[model samples]
Target: MSARRQRWEIRPPAPADVRERLGLPPLLATLLYQRGLLDPAAASAFLAADYATGLHDPFHMRGMAEAAARIAAAIDRGELMAVYGDFDVDGVTAVALLTQAIGAMGGRIRPYIPHRAREGYGLNNVAIGQLAADGVRLLITVDCGISNYAEVVEANRLGIDVIVTDHHHPPAELPPALAVVNPKQPDCAYPFKGLVGVGIAFKLIQALARYGKRPANLRGRDMLDLVALGTVADMGPLLDENRVLVRAGLIALNETARPGVRALMAAAGLAPGLIDSGAIAFALAPRLNAAGRLADARRAYELLLAGDRETADGLAAELNATNRERQALTRQLQARAEELVAQSGRAEQPLIVLASPEFNAGVIGLVAARIAETYHRPVVVIEQGGETSRGSARSIPGFSIIDIFDQCADLFVRYGGHAAAAGFTIATAQIPALEQRLLTLSRQYLRDDQLAPRLMIDAVLPLTELSWELYAGIQQLEPFGQGNPQPILMAPNVTAIDPQPTSDGAHLRMRVRAGNSVFEAIGFHFGRLAEALQRYPTIDLAYQLAVDEWNGQRRMRLLVRDFRRAGGARNGG
Candidate 1:
């Protein structure tokens, strides 16, 4: 099947004043302007994000002082504490980081990452009861517990003072924990609200080191690798403090001392010191997340805390194996999901929903994301459990999945997430009603022109503009994800030369030419259009610049984002 199409939006020219003041190439100046970094000083600061000066005071975050003090006192009193977290990469990294920080602070801490299959998400009352019985006097949550009101109350009743730290949007009725340190709390004054699960945990560690007994071994920067992993994996917007943290965290990740990190990198066929946010998101994070989706998340946490190379290597192998299994299962399930879409004749609907008893609860979110991308529509993949079911949703721009969930809140037993992604549990009998409500809401919010996804083009340039200097200028914006995306340059009416499918027939390797400038281009997922060389005499291409190193020789290459026949741009701004 042909992939979903996108509406291109090419940015207008940068202001002469701003461009002149910045003293950069036109392309560079425009890229900065597009990202809301117009001021030369601010643009300079962003490009050169530093650790010491870039970080905000954790105390500025509401409830941080109390949360830090309480945690410090627990350490001083040698209390048995449990760090409860979710099951995904962000949650596992947070738990591992906190566990290490507490241990280094002379505190007895136990890491608790809930099983994804058995316990859906968040801090469950059953887990709290078990921790209380395990002599846990203090409970600290990371990446979870903001919405876990009953669980926190149960912990409080059991004599376990609970401190909740999460990035998820808070409910109207907040948890009655002793202290809640979350940036998304309505009244919290934390400058950066984009901190992911592990980023918040890193901030807690910073507060502890500053206010409490500063341990010699527990430096906050040392644990930034975990922050980078979780932040990128969780798709946290890479802007402001998040950019700064990930910039420094990438350094820590490149020089990571953890045996498990090294082993994981090796398992992913990556070099030790070459990791960046892109690598974390695509290469490393999935392996860690696979453990949680398939088996226990604690394995991922344990891998991070591994002390020996042997153990780390073994765990990395197991995670890689699990990831392979996850890939095979996802491919199988995605085929079924596509069939469902065709059978329903709602492939063009505002929202696409696929439900089945055979759907694996662990991989529904992955399937939903893929389907949403392929159909250019909001997707909800449900795993029917006879009477009740779990559904994971992924949405395109201008549509909020969580907002739809809130509108249909009465139908869901529980639901929580941000705009782009969400999850819920609903009685299987109510699936029809939920679908109808979602479709209605989606139609009301989305227009016919807005059905397709938009591709934001950073700049329009000829192939002659591609140079080593321009590539270097682009590389300054390191650690790209979410808000801070890699730049996409477009070449109008370029000729496609020698386009051919790759070995797997999923992508295309080609050459593109504009005037006398010709460069190699690789179009991922463009294999279906294998007649690329002959189909179009000329094409307009949107792409990012990449370096292709072959036989130890480096040359500029084009990582094609999309292409179309000349002058075929769909509503470009």
Candidate 2:
């Protein structure tokens, strides 16, 4: 870990009366109150966000009625439809859910996922015209098409009506689709605006179930497994309706009999049980994404839609192999990008731009993300093709990459992304100008302090307060990700006991003691801190509680996030 002060923004103490009224442990109450669940009514609602009761009315979205009516008419008329999607996990699952739902509703829905390397992201006139020529009368875009102004016009000219069910931020001039269904639209009035592409697609399915023809057994709730997969994979905020969706979706996922899901879990080495957002994000999503990153994403889509275990298993193995290949490529590309930045003296710039004709376009995003995290700087990695260049950018906190790119949008062929991560395409001739403008924008938006990594500590506690009850209490805020993260607790003045590196010599396995309490703690990548452990007997440790299961037994373990010397000194990794 890079050297930096571990800033502890300790939560203010809640009123004693509120803790007593909630009948929660003081620590639990403090954590909850710090997360803005102070009042009893708000706290109750958050904890009790069940899917059945928590989902907003489908019609609450602005274009739901119109979109649903059009889809219903198509289903009634038996007009062929297509579900166009992007290449990421969110887009693939969105395509799967919408295709399955509409197909079950007696609509001829075919799935179309654009090639990441060839078609790039979002709608294209080539794919649009091809689908129209193939007799697709209606096009429903999931997770994309928010910025396909010209492509939507092409589809219209080809006599195809489009219902864009996306979650991306739309520009001022909306696509002239049949109905635009995105909560982020300025004129829209959706109660919850954090739905992923799959979440929005699920909402459309729910509306179709209510207003259109469907099989008696085609309950939209049954699709929560896919909803959970896509939502968690996309890193949507685990709050509001999203919390309800994920909470119930996890249940559905654990109990799902879908052969494709089962096979995927097996390939990922995930045991048959409950899975959290972490599992989806780290294990499942990566394997699914590998297909798109290194090969044809259609394999992943087909894996999800696979009917037999044999087919699903074969597809799962392919994805696993692709994921491994992607990992190797990422490591290789990261080294090259880092060396380029260092050798060219580009690391001193506020914005680091590394470009190479040899860089694989598919893995530039992953390389950019890794470099950005390592240096704690805004990074843009551009892959130069024969005539065009594609760039993926990752930003540190306080710097909005998409906003910065918007300031220089005229140089790009196309660009769209969120605050932190974005991708764009431009002609090779514009690379120098893009670099200059990006450096200028970064200087304007980033401060010196923002370049340093800062770990935010949620609360401070003594080891004596650690207990199974407290651990379980903190877990009430489960399904943590993005907007709501796993709480990081600080344990102060713990003496290191039996401090030693693990067998690999990359991590430290040790026992720490505070007063009369002793607990086993493992610090990942903390082997470099052996000298510091010997120098500073006492340290303040930041960690999140994790349950380690071994030999059919479960025990609480501390996964150390960061540590500092007890007396205001930097200590460990």
Candidate 3:
């Protein structure tokens, strides 16, 4: 089936005042202005998320001091503490970071991560009773427990003080825990609210460090590698405090990662000394997440904090094998989901609800994301079981999946997540009715244009802006994510001077000329554009500025993201 193509109207930014503010070249200034940073100070601050400048005082959070004090008291009294976490990469890393910190501080700590298939997500009464029975005096939750009001109450009844360090959105009724240190909490006073679950745990470590409570021997930077892995894997916004943590953490990962991370990197065929965000996102995160997806998350946590190199290597190999299995399962599930969409005769529906009794609950999120991307609509993938059917939902811009579930709260037995992604459970009988109701809700809320995907351009620049200086200047806006994104520049009326298809026939390598400048560009997975290239040499290209190193030489290249015919009525001036 041929997918519908949507044309986007691109407009170049006004370049008059931005040139004078940063004393930058016109192209760099125009790119900066297009990115919503007009002032030099703001541009500099945005680009430089140094550890010294970007980190905020952890105590600024509403309950950080109380949580820290309670943890400290627990250590001093020799009380047993349990770290409760979920069964995902973020949750596992949060548990691992806290476990390492607490152990280093000479505290008795145990980690509890529920099995995805058996125990499900968040705090449960059974787990609470188990912790109490194990003589856990204090329970500090990571990544979860923000909305477990009943579980927290049960823990309190069992004389277990609960401290929640989570990043999930808080519910209307807050859990009455000993101290809730979540940036997403409605009453939180923290400056930056984009911290991930592990990021929040790192903040607790930061708070402990302030009082000389952290281990004297352990360095703060050592744990940053974990922070980067979890922060990026969780898809937390790389802005504010998260930007700082990820920036420093990437450096730590590249230079001096822990033995476990090093071993995993080797197993994944990645060079240990040059890891970047892409490597972590595509290579490392999935392997660590695979354990939780297919098995127990505790295995991942153990791999990260393993003491012996041999064990770490063995665990890394196992994780690699599991990741391969996860990939195959996801592909099968995605294919089935697409088939269901076709059969429904509502493929263009604003929301996709797919259910399969054979679907694995752990990989449903991946399947949902794939469906959402393929159909350009929000998707919810449900895995039917005996008593309840669990589902995971992924959403597009302007549609909050969590809020949509909240609006239909009566239908769900339990649900929680942020705006873009969420998970829930319902009685198996309710699946059809719930799906129909959601489709109706999607029709009511989503407009035709909203359902179409968009490629948002920051600015249109001339070929003169595709210089080394301009590329380096744009790097000032580093560590970009939700609030800040990598700038996309448009170069118009450019003629393809040299075009050739790659050996694999999946990408096209080309050189384009505009005015007196010539630039090299590569369009990955766009070899089909070669047919159109023979008819028209001129094209408008939207791309990100990239620095490419080939054959021991460094040069600037435009990583082409999208393209269209130029110099016609469809092209905007």
What is the TM-score ranking, best to worst? 1, 2, 3
RMSD of each: 1.8, 2.5, 2.9
Give the residue spans of candidate 3 off by over 4 A.
1-4, 11-15, 462-465, 493-538, 547-551, 555-558, 568-573
Number of the predicted model whose TM-score against the real structure is largest: 1
In the range 50-139, model 1's lDDT, one tens digit per residue, is 887889999999999999999899888888999989899999999998888889888889999888888888888888888889899999
Q: What is the lDDT of residue 433 in candidate 3?
A: 88
The whole-model lDDT of each prediction reads: 0.88, 0.86, 0.84
Ten residues in sequence with the least summed lDDT for candidate 1: 1-10
How displaced is residue 196 in candidate 2, in Å?
0.9
* lDDT per residue (tens digit) for residues 141-211 in model 2: 99998888989999999999999988876766889999999998887889999999999998888888788
Clashes, model 2? 0
Clashing pairs for model 2 are none
User: Each model's TM-score?
Assistant: 0.97, 0.94, 0.91
Name the lDDT of candidate 2: 0.86
Q: Count the backbone clashes (under 3 Å) in each candidate.
A: 0, 0, 1
